[model samples]
Target: MNSLSAPQPVPLAQAHRLLNHGPTVLVSSAHGKRRNIMAASWSMPLDFDPPKVAVVLDKATLTRELVDASGEFVLAVPCRAIAEQTLAAGSLSGRDGDKFAALEFETFPASRVAAPLPAGCIAWLECRVIDEPQVQHTYDLFLGEVLAAWADPAEFSDGRWHFSAEGRRSIHYVAGGQFFSTGEAFEVSVTG
Candidate 1:
């Protein structure tokens, strides 16, 4: 909802497409009076029909702890406009205080989850954690079944992404406070 537009619901079947291009996402979680957001680049779609996803959360992070407590989280695809905030979300420790207030990020409530969706993101995936204790304990990998999905229609709709401007573009983290905004898009046709 950055410069793109207000978010509209993306059909459940098309939710997986939001993260299909591997954009870095803002992972938001809340439990009781506490809430936090972290930037994660290691999330991906795991299923289609039920729309599931996978994300790795380090054991030491507070976001992980909150996720474990509440069993819900939101994965939001941030844009170039909020790249700095996204990096700050990943860099800081939420155990200190409320990162949402400390960083001054605006958010809206998610329909199907306790985690609030960051407003500047291009798309959002609200997920309920699927119970997979072995993988979660061993690898810090959490599996989630997407319960609801939303996107800025100007950026994504009809199961396609068409980023046409700098601020409108999604971001990918590289390292050292640097990020790559999504580039010009082109399509390739299949040939037999």
Candidate 2:
């Protein structure tokens, strides 16, 4: 709906924390005059230093094709607030038309990549693909170096999520169109 407020920049060292807990992400890519977004549940942080991330993109999907051509992408973590839209994105194919308008998603430019950042997502990671053609061909998995990262201030700051805003908590996907929001925070210590 509304564009994200001035998102706060997350330090490169802490960017891995964004996806550490496992949330479904909106994978956006742009090449030439076309851009597209798709929902993906199979993405994760692969490294800490230099901030690497791994995500699966289907060979048949336009988003994957775009990423292949552009060598860049943006993984925007959506929340319960836009669950319906996220599901719509996953269900729809991008070859027909503009998915952003079809899904009613608002987006803004990314500084280091052509991929636009979807609005309302709790966090955004702009990435450059690391050349890994063998794995990409065999498994459709992509490895990326996180170039820039951002988070919604009210929800995430100082490399941690403090979910105080409504419907802004990160979400996880279940099978058959079901999803779950992140639960309450808990902490534990060991002294043995």
Candidate 3:
């Protein structure tokens, strides 16, 4: 795992909390000999049980093209430590060469998907495409069923996130090179 110290184990159900605040993610895909990694900010949870996720990927990206062909990909939550590389991935093309290699990111095998999860990510969600051609062509949106998920216990546990340091927290992309660190958390209890 990619943590300053050993991580803690968390319940799978609470996994959604990691993305609740919306962070830019590294989408990983592999099909036969071709594999690619790209940065995506337009991703969100669509459902809970048998968790489903939706991500917007431009039709032109190598990540999209490979994902469309293979029907599988991994959504890895990158942290502030990789913010610069995240922006670089979004700006460059995977068509020319391997973005992961170019960026020097380490990866490990995902349990359910062929794509490798990028290292230094706080969490990883392996998903298989639930095909919707219309959505893919129309909005560049790919929906998937999360086959498996994992997280670094130091930053996430019990479905809630606790960032001990600024560099270890998740990162949200604005535009260009700007980004916001996953801010402090506060709770609101509803009254009926």
Clash-forming residue pairs, model 2: none
Which regions of candidate 3 fall more than 4 Å away from where they truly are?
Answer: 5-11
TM-scores, all candidates, are 0.97, 0.97, 0.93
Q: RMSD to native for every prediction?
A: 1.0, 1.1, 1.7
CA lDDT, every prediction?
0.93, 0.93, 0.85
lDDT of 3: 0.85
lDDT of 2 by residue, 31-96 (tens): 999999999999999999999999999999999999999999999999889999999999999998
Better of 1 and 3 by lDDT: 1
**TM-score of model number 3:** 0.93
Per-residue CA lDDT of candidate 1, range 8-116, in tens? Answer: 9999899999999999999999999899999999999999989999999999999999999999999999999899899999999999999998999988899999889
Candidate 1, lDDT over the whole model: 0.93
User: Model 1 segments beyond 4 Å from truth?
Assistant: 1-3
lDDT by residue for model 3 over 13-111, one digit each (tens)? 765665777889999999988888888999998888768899998988899888988899999889998898888888889999988899888888888
Give candidate 2 regions above 4 Å deviation.
1-4
Rank the models by lDDT, top first.
Answer: 2, 1, 3
